[model samples]
Structures are given as structure tokens and as C-alpha cells.
Target: MKRRFLPVAVAITASTALLLTGCGSSGGDDDSLGKAKGTGGGGEDASAPASPSPKPAGIKRPEVKLPKSFQVEFAGWTNSDPKLQAIMDDGKERLLASYAAIIKGDPQHSALAYYSEGDALRTGTAWVKGFSDRDLTLIGKGRVYQPQPRISPDGSGTLFYCVDEGKGSTKDTKTGKVTATPAGDAFVLYRTKLRKTDEGVWKTTMVQTERRACK
Candidate 1:
């Protein structure tokens, strides 16, 4: 997945949790899918259990104040911009498709949703590695303002955009600093590159952000 970049470094420490047969509290940081938080798990502090996965490491976080069905609506609809709008229904699904992992700051989730594959997960995370401030030059920050259906100079594929409505905040795993953050003022934006596939629907080839100067 491609993203807009801010000029900062954030250390994102995954809880290194594993979804064992037992049921834990499933906090935000707890990775219910893979490794454990402390031991043998390759995530963070293998020595002891972290309190709860706080927000992304370095970025600031906006309160969950969007309308109830935000992400779903975005994921489910294919309407054009301006004339069309994201509502409670499709908006919520859109968020679930991507932010399901975006909320956790996991690049794997982004890669799969946008690229329709897992190849880009590692690369996506690297863009935000060590991100520390709003001024940071990470992907997915500024491009949100650009129009949707963004096509390359050659006009090969389509691109889309969004604000921090669904993806949540990006954190520093090592230092716990949030890098890309959302404030409670207006809509955040992102640029997503896409293409139609044999499946007959537009597919995201890349997702990215362009950093902005907050007034």
C-alpha cells in the first residue's frame, strides 16, 4: 500500500501477541493473530506483558468521533467523488476493509487491502519507520487532498484519497511515538492508486499519504 509521507520517525512496537486457544482482553495493541507479547513472539518487550497496546507509537490520535458506519461505507461503495458521498452504510465497510488493520498500525493489513497482496507490507512500514512529528515526510499524508481516481502520467491506473477517518494513527513501535495523526477538525485525506481486475472491480495498487502543514 502507498501512503502520504510526513517528515518524522515513529517507533511502532507491536505487542507480539499470539491468538492462543485462550481468550485475552484483545486490547488495541494485542495482536490476536500472530506471535505472543513477551516470550518467543517477535513483537516488542518479550520480557513482560505490556499494559494495553496504546495508540500507534508516535502519531497523535483523533477521538473515534466519525459517524457510526464510516469505514463500512467507504469499503462498500464505488461511486465517484463530488457528486457521490460516503454515508453511514458503505462508509463503515470501507474502513473495515483497510483500517481493520490500519487501527493496529500494521502494514500487512494495508498491503493486503490496497495491493490485493502482501508484498508491500514491509515496504509500507518502512516509510513510517522512526516517524516522530507532523512535519515528518512519510507517505499518505499530503496526497489526501489530491482528487480521487488519480492516474499516473501515462494514465495506466486509478487512484483514490481519504483522511484519517478510518486508518487511525501510526505509532512508533520502539518509542511509542505516533507519527501520522488525525485531529478532530475536518476530514483527513489519503491517495490510493487502483486498477480494475479480472474480477470486474477496481483494485488498489498502492496507497500513500502526503504530509501537510497544520495551521
Candidate 2:
């Protein structure tokens, strides 16, 4: 999901500002963690299922529905630790919820709010609004891969991943015109922070995306 409004470098800086506002004074922490390498490729398609998967006995998960025109895949995201795996799963859901909001032309979509809070919520809302304001929507396929997740001693967590947008494009909502995105802008690296709630759902609190940061 590259935006056409600003240059990539400028957008990266602005997005960082939006997501890192309250990330604490320990500025070096994120830099060090960002260097960790992740491994993964190919993921299950993100098309909505006819019936949602059964929820775990005691946990509550939101149902996310996306139009068939848009698809996302998460590759090699398994973790040996169930807790870490849960974080990755929710992070994937959070991203889908955001894209769903954009495609639906709703900046304040409830599903998006369900998986996000704090800086992530605010910035995610604004990002969706950008497309809606321009009467734009996305179509085609997107891939998220190479996820590296870590949990802190205090229960908070961070995830780093790469996104491939080469097969995705933006469409005019009213005019039905599709614009191909540049190959150079198709790859991005993302870093996000999350926390688990009492209900056992992990919600994203912050995010940072760097264009051309991945191959």
C-alpha cells in the first residue's frame, strides 16, 4: 500500500511521526530491534470465507470481511510459541481490517478500531481517510511476509515484516480507473508495537513503514 500523495521518503518520515509519538524516550530500542532478520514466504489467501473460522473457546475475535477484489497473503508466519503466534495472527488481522476500511470507504470502520488503539488507531484512521477523501480504493493482490516478532518481559511486543504490493493497484471509486503502482514503491518494511488486553486479544498500538526497505 503505497500512497500517491507524497514522496516515499517524506511519507516514511511522516508515518514514523504518527506511530512513534508515545513510544517512550528509549529511542535506541526500536532501532536495535529493527535490525532483526525475519524469515517467511507465501501465505494463505485473504479472501473472506463463506463461514468464519470457529473461535477459540474463551477468546473473542472480530470477523473481518473483505471484498473479493482485494486479497492479502501472509507467508511463513508461524511461531513455536503460541503467544507469539497469536500476536502475529492479530497483527495480520489488524492490517486486513485497515484495508477493509479503505476499500469500504469508511475511515472509522469498527473492525479497524477493534484491532488497533493509541497511535496506531489514530494514524490508521487517517491513512484510510486519505483514500476515501480521494475517492480511491484498492484492488488486486498484496503479500505480507518475513515476520519477526518479539515479546518484552513486560508483556508488550513488536513485530517487523515486509509487504509486497507489486500486484496491487489503486482504483477510482467513481470512475472505475485503475492505476498501476511503480515497482520501486511496491516493497516496504514495517515495524509495529502491540499489547495484549485482558480479553487476550492483541491490539496494535504503533506502526512504522519504510518504502523500498525490502526486496
The best candidate by TM-score is 2
The ten-residue window of minimal lDDT in model 1 covers 11-20
Clashes of each: 95, 2
**lDDT score for candidate 1 against the true structure:** 0.31
Candidate 2 residue 40 C-alpha distance from true site, Å: 11
lDDT of 2 by residue, 29-50 (tens): 5554455463233244343322
**Which parts of model 2 are misplaced by more than 4 Å?**
1-17, 20-28, 38-54
Least well predicted 10-residue stretch by lDDT in candidate 2: 45-54
lDDT of 1 by residue, 98-205 (tens): 333433444444323443432123434443232322222222321122223433443334333333222334444465565444443224333333444443334443
Name the candidate that leads on lDDT: 2
Candidate 1, after superposition: displacement of residue 213 in Å? 7.8
The 0-to-1 C-alpha lDDT of every candidate, in the order given, reads 0.31, 0.74
Clashes of 1: 95
How close is every model to the real structure, measured as TM-score? 0.34, 0.83
RMSD of each: 19.0, 4.5
